[model samples]
Structures are given as structure tokens and as C-alpha cells.
Target: MTVGGDGGPSSPEAGPDLDAVRYLLVGYSADLLVDLDGFLPERSVAVVETPDVIEARGVRGQIGAVRCLAAVLAAPIQDEANAVRLVGLVPRPPRIGAVVPASDYGVVAAATLAAAWGLPGAGPDAAPVFRDKAELRRTAGGAGIAQPEWRLVTGPAEVAAFRAGGDGTCVLKPTNRQASVGVQILPPDADVFTAWALTAGAEEQMFRPGDAGGSRYLAERLLRGPEVSAEVLVRDGRTVFFNTTAKDVQPGRHPVETGHVVSGPVTEEVAAALATGMRALVEATKFGSGVLHGEWIVVDGVPHLVECAARLPGDYIVELIAMAYDWSLLHGFLAVLEGRAADPAPPVARGAAIRYLSAAPGTVDAVDGVEQARAVPGVCDVLVRVAPGDTVEPVTSSWKRPGHVIATAPDAPSAARAAEQARAALTIATHPGAGR
Candidate 1:
């Protein structure tokens, strides 16, 4: 592993002096780190990532200005001890600005390191609550926040009992996994054993073998309603910016998100309920500073908590939020993390939406219409991650989806329509009969 200060000599006895660094970025996202480097070109950044990710992403070559520190860990960084060790690679803690997580797996480590260093971040005790769904449910429930009925299960019989106790249907998911990897919605007559096996065996592709979360699971009574996520920025346990994002999910055993629209309209009552729920969650978690992405199901104008994350949201939602509001969420997130107040969100200037690309499960033969999709009115970007000879699997999770199209317009419906139209303009021809 390579570890050194900025343009300094490497020595085993004398480690790098990180005193000049202002931010310690945890996790690996090449594009995000580069953007952050651009945002604060003058400020020094120290990044902690696995050696494999550093090599695969060419992180050092991409972000020349950012100092790259690699650590070969016995466990994932989400593990608090491993997180501490990863950040400890820096000879000394940087300035008292912030420690930021670039991905879901970095939240706990970032929070823990920030607290230990006396920098602004989610409280050390509260970061794990955001990562673990069961704990989040308990915390939110204790705060009198509404949520669907849920229970932890370790075996098939417990899942069966939970389903039986519910209204003949339930959702089973891993307590700590993200991107819907181990999530499934079972009907009244669904096979409990098969569902349990599938959910238990699921794993995230990003992690190395044996580095994923444990086999903990939760069975919850599935609530029905329009699903939305609240993107919020908080400082000193107070909300400074909040926006409601409308969501679309695949209707099947796995509820993988398909799209999201920022600054979308909601009824007055539902908006109020969402605000109240957000406040309750912030207080319950005792979150100190940074971004909070909370999901909810609005039933009868009441928003029920669906788990939240302390890190920046995935799936280009941050970019969409910036486009819709004519401001930078990244800027606000950095500001709050640096112990400075975030700028109050302005009124929605436009609507921004993203629609993901999907094709039948098979081997891709050809891709077409990408440029045409980009030419569509209001279409800002269209990205197709698959190519000829690539295998396209069933959309069981966010990573399985191939690509997406982003659009902006005067209103939410118009932006959503434009995004869908642009997505329809593209095509990925696949040879059928490849099973998932």
C-alpha cells in the first residue's frame, strides 16, 4: 500500500504530516472525489480506500491533487474498528473541518472518525443506528415516529410466524445491506423457505468475499402507498434544507428503485407529515451535521419511516436536486460538515428526474439511440452502462439496471415525462432465454 504526504518523501519511521489536509474522505467514488477536489481545489484532501479499489479505479491518477491512502483491511470499513484503522493510516488527524463519507459503507467510519477528531459529523453512537435498519426502527419508534410493524428473524420459522401474525404478507430484508440486495416482498401464499433462502444468500457485489454484512434479517408488514425520499441537510441537530423526491420502484419480489423526481409536488398534509417525521428522526438519532436521506411510505397522508442513511444519497439524486433547485447540494453538504450553516434551500425553480434503463434478462447484442436520446427536449444526460456481448440480468437491485436518463423541465410531471421519453428512445437488443 502507498501512503505519503502531499509531494513529500516516504519513510517508515516518519509518516506523512496530514496537518495541512482539511478533509478526510472515506470510501471510493472516483467521480465524487474528483468533483469534491474541484469544489475545493485549494483545500487538501486525504482519502482512505482499499488497495483493490484504488488500482481498479485508478483513483490516484484521476484525482492528482487529492492524497490517496490505501489500506488492506481484514474487514470492510463499515466495521467501526476497521474504519478507525483505515483513517489511522494518516499519521495524524487533519484540520478540524470534517470527515465525509462518499458511499454507504463509509458512513459509520466517517462519523466515528469525525467524532474522535472533534470534527463535525453524525454522532459516533448515532451513525450505526442509521446503518442498521432494526436499530433505526427502534430509535424512530421510541421517538413516536410512525413505522410499519417489524421484527428481527434468524430462521425460516420466525419469518413464517411474522408473516402469519401480519396480514398475510411481509417484506424481508437484511438489517445492514443497501441497494435492495437482500430485500424481498412475499405474498400471503408465497413460499417462506424459498424467500428465506434467497434473502439470506444475497450479497452486495461491491464487497469482497466474506466482507458483506452478517445474516441478520427483518420481517415487516408491507405498507402500501406512494414512496418518497426526503433529502435533508442538518446542522447542530436542526434541519436547514429539505426536499421531497418522488420515487418509482419495480413491482415484483424485489422492490428495486427505478427512478426518482426531485422537487415533486405533494399534498399539504402529506408534506407536513413528512416534515414532522424528518424532524423526529433527526432528533431521535441525535445527528449533529451533514446530509440525511430518509425513505418513507405515505399512507393516508401520514409518512411511515422506511430507514434512513447519514451519507450522501446514491443514484444521481444529488445532481437532480441541484438541477431542480438551482443550487448545489454538495456545497451545502460540505458547508454543514465544516461546522458552517448550510444555505437555506431556495424555492423549486424547475423539476429534475432520472429514469433508469432496463431490458429483458439476456445477453446484449446491440445498443442504439444514445445520441438521439440525448437530443430529446429537456434531456440533460443519457448513460448506457451495457454494451454488445454484455450480460443483462433481471433488475433485482440498483446495480443490475444498466443506465439512466436525466431531464429537467418547468414542473415535475413534465420532467418525468421527458425522462421517460428519452429513455424510450434508447434500445438495448438482447438474446432471450438467459435465466436469472
Candidate 2:
């Protein structure tokens, strides 16, 4: 998930090209794929995906310099078998010097592929601990890392048992899913049977051919306090926090992250607490290297682990971090990918924020304010998802976000205000319709 665009041609920190390193990125989508023109030499990256998909994401247009190897990547998350198949597709000569997963789903595959190629990052051994929430809790608990009380619940009976033990309310999350896809907070009086039955056929957490409908849920105590995510750069088991972002979310059944503000003002006390917990998490998981997007909730001033991803944070966090720090995070990621040290020092201070646009489930009728949002002061970018005819659904995960506005200012409050104003200026008209 090392960045491509900022390193493509603009930034002075793009550094000397690492053309000698033939890196293989096992990916799920081309949506955020960057043109690694300046980071890596042309024709050096071979992306495994279908031709149409490559075109659909503007991959050919955005990252046409990289090679696109047509193949059907069916699963969002892949197992070792998928990794093996992806490895077989690589021609023997060039020899991939590094392996990177383009998304969370591709992490296990990247690790497995790296192990096969004798690359630097964590191998298949670290996959399960990072991929499965249940496994993650077990490992962290074994290491005495503080976490919300949790248990792997396979059925209604187990859910009942878990509730009877402690808090009547619990949060249920898919073991392998990201973006809080199947994360739901069950109330004390909610029907466990209905909850289990409704989530029984959920397939977004699918890995291999089997285990699709098995116990994909992990029930845990609903931790209080503000939610935040740490964007850390880890190299050879050493980790550094680049930025901590405050999240604005609606965790009503389906967790929907609405906005983010770069948290620059951290009390030294809270900082130490977060560092201790995050460091313990890194050690417990044995995440040898690469970028980690760690989610945490600070309850009663103590940070508890939510989840950590062995990849970059989605939703333009990398880009936002760069705007805030005025430092090349993507370059740091690239350095780490090559098993080298990265200067994560902040050279400048600023704030960047992103606010997502949510729409009611309906059909897009008329839309306005794209140009207006972009014109707002500090507004860096404005993305609109719905069109005149496209059906817009209530946001589930980040999939249904109507659009988002990114802005930056000298400080966090200003930046957040800019984002809010920018998003508010936009207008979306819709009619009631079926969810997408």
C-alpha cells in the first residue's frame, strides 16, 4: 500500500528510483493504485487483475506504466492457495525483490508470496494473527496487551453465554472483514437468534471455498471513549507512529466512518499510554515490517486495541498524512518495503481532514456542488460517487459513501471546519429506491 501518485513525479522526497527492485503487489482493486513512475521504473510492477477491472479503475490511465497481468482475483481475501497461484503467474527471470499487498485482503497472500520468494517482510506465520480478529485477541491477550473482553461466538447459544457472563451489550465483528463491514453492536434486549440468522449468509468475509458461513463473528465488550486510528511505519519489527487520526463514526449496527481529523494535539500522558499499547500490539502480533493501520478506542483515558491492518489505511489517510506532516510517508513506506530505515520526522506542522458524504438509500436524481466543493478554501479534493441515474444506498462500510471532501489548514480545527463547510456546500438529490 505504499503510495504511487505523490511519489510519481511531484514530491521532492520521491528519492532515487528503486528500479532494481522488482516488487510484486497482490491486490484486490485498482481504485487507489498509483503510477509508480518515479518510485519504481516503468514496467517494473506486475499487477494481477482482470484487464477490464484494470481499465475500470483507470488503472491503465492512472498507472499505465506498470504491467497489468490479466487474472481473475475472485476473493477479496485470499488464502495460501491464492498466494501460490499468484506466485505461479510470475515469470522466473526478473525475480520479485519485494512483495506488497495493495489492500487488507491481499495481506496474507503478500506474506505467503514473500515467504516463497525469501523477501523481507513478515511471512505466512504472521498472517492469521493480523487477519483474524479472534486470533489477534488471543495473541495480544497472551502478551498481556489490554483489550476489551472478547470471545469467539459461533452461534446464538454462544452469544447468549457471552452476554450472560458480563456486559449485556456486545460488539460483533467479522474475523477477517475490514471497514467494519459486519461490525454490529447488539443491545441488551436484542434477539441473538435474529442477529445470528441475519448474518448467517454474509459472504463478504469469504476466504477460501469453505468457511463462508461458519463462525465469522467475534463478540466483544463495547468499549467507550473516542475512536482513533494510528498510521504507523514499521520496519524489521521496529515501528514509528506517523500520525494519529480521530474518527467520527456511526456504529449503529453497521459501523460507518464519516470523517477524520488528524490528531496533532495529544497530551503527553495520553501519548505514552497509546505508545505502550501500540508497541505491545506490534510485538505480540510479531508484525516484522510494513505499514500498520491500527484502530484503537481510548476508554477512560486508556487505549484499547480495536484492530490493526498490515496495510495502509484506506480512505486517503496516507495522502492526508502527507498534507498534515509535509513529510513523505509514502517514501517511508517505500524505504521500509526495501527493508531500509525511513526518516519519519515531521519537518512541518499542519492539519488535514476528510469528511465523508452520506446519502439516504435512493436513486440519484440531480447532483450539484462538485466544482463548488473543490473551490472551497483548503479543499484539496472532492469525490462524488452517485450520478444522475446511479442508485445510492445508505452507507454500509465505506462502500456506499456518496462522496467525500478532503481539506487542509494550518491546524486541525480549521481543517475540520473547512471540510465541514466544503461537504455542506454540496447537494445531492435522490428518490427512495432499493439499496445497491
Per-candidate local distance difference test = 0.80, 0.70
Expressed as tens digits, the lDDT of each residue in 338-430 for candidate 2 is 677888667448889999987667888878888888998999999887788788876666776888999999998889999999998898888
Q: Evaluate model 2: give its TM-score.
A: 0.84
Query: Candidate 1's residue-wise lDDT over 110-214, tens digit each?
Result: 887787777889887788888889999999989999999999998889999999997899999988878999899999888999999999888764542355446
Pick the lDDT winner. Answer: 1
lDDT (0-100) at residue 208 of candidate 2? 25
**In model 1, how large is the Cα lDDT of residue 262?**
85
Candidate 1, residue 295: CA error in Å? 0.3
What's the C-alpha lDDT at position 62 in model 2? 40
Q: Tell me each candidate's RMSD, in Å, in order.
A: 3.2, 6.6
Supply every candidate's count of residue pairs whose N, Cα or C atoms clash at under 3 angstroms. Answer: 0, 0
